[model samples]
Target: AQSVTQLDSHVSVSEGTPVLLRCNYSSSYSPSLFWYVQHPNKGLQLLLKYTSAATLVKGINGFEAEFKKSETSFHLTKPSAHMSDAAEYFCVVSLLTGTASKLTFGTGTRLQVTL
Candidate 1:
């Protein structure tokens, strides 16, 4: 089984400053890591994903995350924050079981931006 742990439930950032959202995962095999964003009353959107292709993966909205096998961590970071970026973020772990992959979502982190 694969699982994800989001360290923080809420993260507040000032507009234009860097942002960080920590996450960790547990999996018996190499799992695919993904970051998803959900705006108010909106559907979830894939921000970025790491599928054993690269250690450092870049995503939309200047967001990026580095997959560290040794640490079992995939923390999302952005160079700067925007008010529009405020939303709920989910760290997901996907594992191939049989023919289809199953996704496990973390607790979710809500990002709040203040001007």
Candidate 2:
């Protein structure tokens, strides 16, 4: 079984500031982790992903996450925050079950960006 936990329910930041969103996971086997962002009325966008490849993964809009197997964590970070970055972020953990993988989404963290 695999599960994800978003440590923060809400995060507020000013424009140009660094952003950090914490996440932790538990899995019985090697897992695939992902960070997704969703705007108020839009579809989910992949921020970054950690499969079996690199430990540090980078994605769109200068976002990145490091898969830490020792800590069971995959935390998301951005060098600078933009107003457009204000959205809900979800940390997801997925594992192979039979012939397919099943995803389990974490409780989302809502980011509030201010000018």
Candidate 3:
């Protein structure tokens, strides 16, 4: 089984400041990891993905995450925060089960950007 844990349920940051959202994962087999963002009533958007290609993956809007196999972590970071960045972020783990792919989602981290 695969699972993900988002360390923070809520993260607050001032506009133009740095942002960090921590995540840890576990899987018996090699896992495909992804970060997704949802703004207000909008649909989830893919931020980035790690599929054993690179340890460091960059995403949209200047966001990035590093896959650390040793620590079992894939934490998201951004040098600066924007008001548009305020939303719900999810840490996901994907696995191929039979002929289908199953995705496991974290509880999620709600990002709040302040002025």
Candidate 4:
């Protein structure tokens, strides 16, 4: 069985500071891991993905995650948080399940940016 776990439901940051969000996952095979950001009432945009390749993966909008096989964790990070980064971030796991490709998402983490 494949599964994913997101550690935080919400995060708050001041503008121009760094951002950090945590995630963990479990899978039978070397699964694909992704971090996606969604604007309000908008579709999910892929931020990054790990497909049994590099351990440290970079994504758009200055976001990056390190795939830790030993720890089974993929935590997203950025050097600075912009006001535009104030959105809901979702940790997603994509895997195959019996004739269907599916995505199991975390509850979601809302990032609040303050001045």
Task: List the candidates' TM-scores in order.
Answer: 0.98, 0.96, 0.98, 0.93
Name the runs in model 3 displaced over 4 angstroms: none
lDDT digits (tens) for residues 39-77 of candidate 2: 988999988889989999999999999999999999999
Q: What is the alpha-carbon RMSD of candidate 3 to the true structure?
A: 0.6
Better of 2 and 4 by lDDT: 2
lDDT of 4: 0.90
Predicted structure 1: lDDT: 0.97
Expressed as tens digits, the lDDT of each residue in 58-106 for candidate 3 is: 9999999999999999999999999999999999999898999888999
Count clashing residue pairs per candidate. Answer: 0, 0, 0, 0
The reply for model 2, stretches above 4 Å from the true place, is: none
Q: Spell out the clash pairs found in candidate 1.
A: none
* Model 3 score (lDDT): 0.97
Q: Which pairs of residues collide in candidate 3?
A: none
lDDT of 2: 0.94
